[model samples]
Target: MRPPAQNPPTPQTPDPATAAGAPEPRTSPDTPDAHEPPDGEEAQVIVVGAGPAGASTAVHLARAGVDVLLLEKSRFPRDKVCGDGLTPRGVHQLLRMGVDIDGPGWMRSRGMRWVCAGRQVTIDWPDLGRYPDFGLTRSRHDFDDILARHAEASGARLRLGVKATGPVTDRAGRITGVTATGPDGRPVTYRAPLVVAAEGASARTAIAMGLERDPRRALATAARRYYRSPELSKDEYLELWADLRCARTGRDLPGYGWIFPLGDGRVNVGLGALPHRDHGTIDLRATLDQWLARLPRHWGLNEQNADSPLRSAALPMGFNRHPQYSRGLLLVGDSAGMISPWSGEGIAQAMEAAEVAAEAVVLALTRPDGPRRDQALQRYPAEIRRRWGRYYRLGNTAGDLVFSRFGYRPILNGQVMSRPGLLASLARLLTHLMEDPPRDTADHVLNTLVKAVPLRGR
Candidate 1:
C-alpha cells in the first residue's frame, strides 16, 4: 500500500522584515524630505505598482543601467488576490530575471490535470531536457516581495507606500511623468521620460490616460485560498475541476475551479467564472466548499488542517484585443488585460510584457528626440498584438464556448481531452510562432492555423 501523504505547510502571516530582507521601508525619491535634484533632473523611466509586472519591468530596465523609479501604493510583502499558479513560461521568465525561485521555500510542479464529468486527463509540459519541471506555486505575498527585492538589488529605486495620483503631460499631450501622493499624504511630482503602468485589473492609470476597454470582453471573477492538505504532498499535477453543477448555479460558469499544489502538503485552490449575472451572484465560498467536500479521501483535507481565510477578486478577461501603449506610456500585465482568455493565466504574460517593455524603454531612452523613440514606443503595442493576438482572441472565443450550456460537453471531450496531440501541436505551434522573426515552415503552418481558428461568435 502507498504511504500516507505528507501534511502541507501551514499558512503563516507574512512578515516583511523577514521576507523582504529590509528592516525599514524604502521611501520614494519624491518624498517630502527627499534631497532636491540640482535644478534640472529627470528619471529615465517610472514604473507604477510593485507587483510582478512592475517589479519585473523595473528590474530588467535597471539591470541595463537605466535609471528607474518604482512606486507602490502598498508596502512590501502585501497580499495580492490571485490564483497564484505559475506556468512554465512564468518560471522561465523568472529565471531570466535572475530570480532563484527554487531556492528553499518554493513548491515545484510538473504538469496539469483536468477532471470533469467523471473523466480525467493530464498534459505533460514540454521538457527542454534542462529544467526540472514545468512550473511552481507560491503565494503572491511572498512572490511579489521576492521580485521587488530583486528589482532593488538590480539598481531600481523602490518607493513603497506611494501612490501615483495622475500622469504629468507635456504641452504636446505626451506623458512626461506622474504626480504621486506619498505616505505622508503630500503630493510630489516625479519627472520621467517614459512611464509604465503595471497596475492590475483596475486599470486606474490606463483609464486616466484615456484607454478604453470593451466591457463585453471583460468577464470572470476569481476567489482563492491557501489550504493545508496532507493529501496534496505527492500530487504533482495542477488539478482543475470543470464541473460547476455542484455549486449553486446547477451549471458551471465559463471558467473552471483549480487546485494547484504548492508542495509540502499545501495547495492553492480557487474558482473563476465568466460573466453571468446569476453565476456571478452565486456565493463563491459556498461553491468552493461544495467542491472541496467531494475531494478523494486520499487527497487529505480536514477541519483540523489550518487554512487561510478565502480571498476573492474579479478577473478581467477578453481585454487583450486592443493596443495597450500610447505616446510616452506603456501598460503591462493585467493593466493591459494580458491574462490569457483561455487559461486565465497572467503571470507569465505579465513577465513577458515586462521584458518587452523594458527593451522598448531602453531603446527609446537612447533617442529621446530622434525618431527612434517614436519607433520604439510604436513597436510595443504592435509587437504584443502580433505575438499573442491570435491565441488570445481564440482563447476568448473558446472561453465563451466552454461556459455556454450547449458547447461545454463537446469542447471537453472532443477538443481538449480526446485530441491531446492536437492540443500539444497547438502549444508547440504557438511557442514557435511567438519567436522573433518567425522560423521557416513552422511559422507558415502556425500562421495558417491561427488564421483558420474561428474567432467570431462562439
Candidate 2:
C-alpha cells in the first residue's frame, strides 16, 4: 500500500474527562515545561535510535500529526555494520516513506544467482510492472542518513548524539519518559507518553523493562569489504557461493559467501556460518582472501579492482523470541530480534514493524478513553506476533537444517537443486502464506506450532 500523505491532522486529543484520575505530567529538565498537566497536552511519542525501525516509526507518526521525539546515539551519515543489502520489500517501505531510492550511487538488483554444489540456479523476482522486482544496495552510512533526513523533514524532532540511559516511571510503574546522556555527556530526560525502542541487538530498553532475552540461534561471524571491480555487472543479482567440503570444521558449516555488485565497479563480499561450528575457529579475513583469490580465476571478482577496508560483525540469527511490545513501550528492528533466521535479513522486517507500531500508537492515543486505551497498546504486540511469528519460526527451522553440513547438503543438492520448485514454494510460503497484519486464526495456529517445535538438536 502507498504511504499516506505527509502529516495528517492530529487525532482528537484524549478527553480530559476520562483522564481525571491520571497522574499529573512531570516536566523534565530538558523539556520546555516539566510540570504541566498531561491532559490536553499534545501526546508526544519518543522513538529511540535513528535506524530503519526508528526512522520509519517517526516518519509515519509525524505524518499522522503526532508529535514525535526521535533520539539517536550517533550522528548522521554514520556507518552501520551490515551487508548493505536491501530486499524488494525494503525498497517498498522506503517508497512508502516518500524517499526516492532509485538514483545515482545506489545499486539496483533484478534477482539472485545461487551457486551451490557446483550447480547454478537463478530466480527472477516477482514482477511489479514499472517497479523493479528486487532491491537496491547502498551503505548504511548514506542509507540511514537519508531516512533520518526524511523523518526530520516530515516534522519529527530528531536528537542525534543523545543516548537513552533508562526509563522514567510513575508510582504506578507505567513508563512516562526516558533518561538519556546528551552528546556533551550531560544527563538529560525526555518526557513522553509512549516510547518506541528501536535500539539494535543489545536492547538496553528491553532489559531495563525486565524483559528476558531468548534468542533462537546465533550466526557465525561475518566480514565484508568493498572492492573496485569493473567486471561486476549491476543487474541486481546477488551471488552466493556454497562449498560444503571447504569448511574448516568437518560439521560442514552451512554458510555461503556473497558478492553483491554495486553499479560503480564496487562489490560487497561477506561470509557467515553457524555459531558453534565456526565461531573464532576460522580467520574470516583470510577466509575472505581465499574466496577472493579463487573468484578472479572462476567468478567475476578481478584482483585489479579491489578497494575499501574489510568490515565485520556478528549477525543475530533466528527469532529472538522476546516479547516485542509491553505496557508503555514497544520494540522494533534488531532490538526486538526481528532478523531473519535463514538469511539474517532485518531491514525489511524492521521497516514493516515500525509502520505497524506507528499505526497502533495512533489508535492508542486517539481512541475514546477507557480500557480501550490499554487494548490499543495490546494491539501492537498481538498484530506483530500474528504477522511475523510463523515466518520467523520457519526461518529458525530452516537455519537448523541448513547449518548442519550433513543435513543441508542433501536438502540443497536433492530437494533445493533438483526441484527448484521446492525452494520456490518455500519462498512463496514465506512471502504470502504467512500473514502481514495477520488474522486471529493464523496467529493461533502459528503460536501453537512454534511453541510445539523443539529448539535444540532438531
Candidate 3:
C-alpha cells in the first residue's frame, strides 16, 4: 500500500492542499486581454501557486536562464495537510531540484511495512542506478517552503501572498497571462507569453480555460494528524495498515491507514480511502478512531498525544483533469490531477511533472509564438502520457475493476503477505519503479500488464 498523505505538524508533510478555485460557470466578457492590462507586470513565464509544481517549474525554468514569476497565496512555513512520506521517486526529484535533503528536519526512510490480517511484511526500497535508495519525510509546511526558496535561489522571481484569481486571455480565448490579487489587496495582472498553472487540485484556472475534471477519473480523500509518538517518531519504515473497516457496520472497507515517522517527536498518522461502492459513506473520523484503537498499545497514540487537529482533504488522482496544456496555459502538479491512483502518491508525480512541464515550456518559449510554439507546448501532455500514461491507465483500470469493490482487502490477504518477494515486487509495480527494459520476471510481467491495459478513452 502507498503511504498515506501525512499529519499536519510532522517535519515531513504531504503535498500541500489543493489550490482554492471553484468550477468555472462561464467566461465573462469583462476578462482582461493578454496584451492590454492597466499596470500589468510582465515575465517570460508566469506560474501560479508556488507549491511543489509551481516552485519546481520555476526552479527548472529559471535555472535554464528563462525569466519566471512564481506566485503564492500564503507565506512561508504555513501548514498544509499531507502524509510527509516521500518514496524514492520523490527523493530523486528533490535531488534534481538541488534540495539539501541531508540537512536538518529531513527524516530518511528505508522502505515500507505492510500490516494486514494479522500478517506483516517489510520491504526495502529497491536500489536502482537511476534513483535514490532511501526515501524522505518532511511536513508540507516545510516541504513547500523549501521548494519555494529553492526556486527563488535558482533565480525564479517569487511573489508571496499573491493569489492568482484567473487566467488573462486574449480575444482568441488563449491564455496569455494571469490576473491575481496582490498582497496589498489590489487587483493585478501579470503578463507572459506562456503561463503555467502549478497550483494544486482546485483547477479553477483550468476550468476557466475550458478544461474540466473527467468524470471517469478517480478521486480520493486523505485525512491526517500529527501525534507525539516518541516510540515511533524515528522509525525507518512507513507503516501501512490495510485492515481498515467501517466502525458502525463492522464491515471491512477498501482503504488503508498509515503511520509515518517524522523524527521530531511525532509521527504523521493518516488514512485515505478511494471511492468505494458499498462503503462509500463510511465515517472517516470514526473509522480512524477504530483503526487507531487496534494498533500496538506501546506506540502511545491517544487523543491527548495528538499534536494537531485531524484534518482531511481531497486528492484528485489519475489525471482527472486533462488537456494539461491548453491555450498558452500548462497545467502542472495537482492542477492536472497527476496523483497516482495506485499509491495515492502525488509529491513525486507533481515534482516530476514540473520537470516535464519545464522542459516543454523552455522549448516552446524558444520557438516563435505560432503553430510551432503551440506544437511544442502540446508535447508537454503527450510526453507525460508517454512516460506514465500506461501505468496510470492500468491503475485506473484496476481501481475500477478491483479496488472499487474490494479495496485493499484482497491484496492484503495472507497469501499475498506470505511471500516477501511477491510483496516486494508488488511495491515496485505500485510505485512505478520497475526497470524500463524488463530486466527481470517482475519487470517483464508488470510491463506486459501495463501494455495490455487499454488507455482510457483509447
In order of listing, the candidates' clash counts read 5, 5, 17
Query: 35-123 in candidate 2: lDDT tens per residue?
Result: 43222112368899999999999999999988888999999999887778876778888888888776678888876666776676766
lDDT for model 3 comes to 0.82
Q: Worst lDDT window (10 residues) for model 3?
A: 7-16
- lDDT by residue for model 1 over 169-284, one digit each (tens)? 54334566677787777777767767899888877666666665666675567898877886775577788776655366665555678888776667788887665444346577
TM-score of each model, in listed order:
0.82, 0.79, 0.92
Model 1 Cα shift for residue 272 (angstroms): 1.2
Q: What's the CA error at residue 398 for candidate 3, in Å?
A: 1.1
lDDT of 1: 0.69
The models' CA-based lDDT, in order, is 0.69, 0.67, 0.82
Tens-digit per-residue lDDT, 23-73, candidate 3 = 332344334346433545678888998888899999999998888889888
lDDT for position 418 in model 1: 63
Index of the highest-lDDT prediction:
3
**Candidate number achieving the greatest TM-score relative to the actual structure:** 3
Clashing pairs in 2: 7-63, 27-34, 109-236, 227-307, 228-305
Which one wins by TM-score: 1 or 3? 3
Model 1, residue pairs in steric clash: 8-264, 8-265, 8-266, 231-299, 231-300
Which one wins by TM-score: 1 or 2?
1
